[model samples]
Target: MDSTIRTAIAAADGDDPYRALRQLHHARIELTRELDRAEALAVRRARTAGASWQVIAMALEVSKQAVHKKYGRG
Candidate 1:
């Protein structure tokens, strides 16, 4: 997906193992932040399109209460 994530998976390895590990750690943080933003945006769009919290939760594999708590009613 993202170049940083792709690099983490495909290239962040073993020339100098310690340095690669550090780069991978940072990439993981970046990837998690990106994913959180993306998930938030998707939830917004889904809600706009009249999706129920239960439907969204089903798609996300979380409980309805968890999704509602995380995104709230809008």
Candidate 2:
């Protein structure tokens, strides 16, 4: 959704439209993985800083049980 990514996709679409869309989808997936990694790191840091699962879950807009299940054992 970023302007830079939009520009890139537009340029790519000018060449081979389908290939450009596929590449953009792949890029979005990769970006999502990176974001997940960053979020996990931040969660770990928050836990270390004495933040509770409920607090983290509230910040993430997810259930506390869900957050705990995801990060509690790991």
For all candidates in order, the CA lDDT equals 0.87, 0.85
Assess every candidate by TM-score: 0.81, 0.80
Q: For every model in order, what is the number of clashing pairs? A: 0, 0
**Candidate 1 C-alpha lDDT tens digits along 52-72:** 999999999999999999999
Which pairs of residues collide in candidate 2? Answer: none
When summed lDDT is taken over every stretch of 10 residues in candidate 2, the lowest stretch is 1-10
| Candidate 2 vs. true structure, TM-score | 0.80
Q: In candidate 2, how many Å is residue 70 off?
A: 1.3
- Best-performing candidate as measured by TM-score: 1
lDDT of 2 at 69: 94
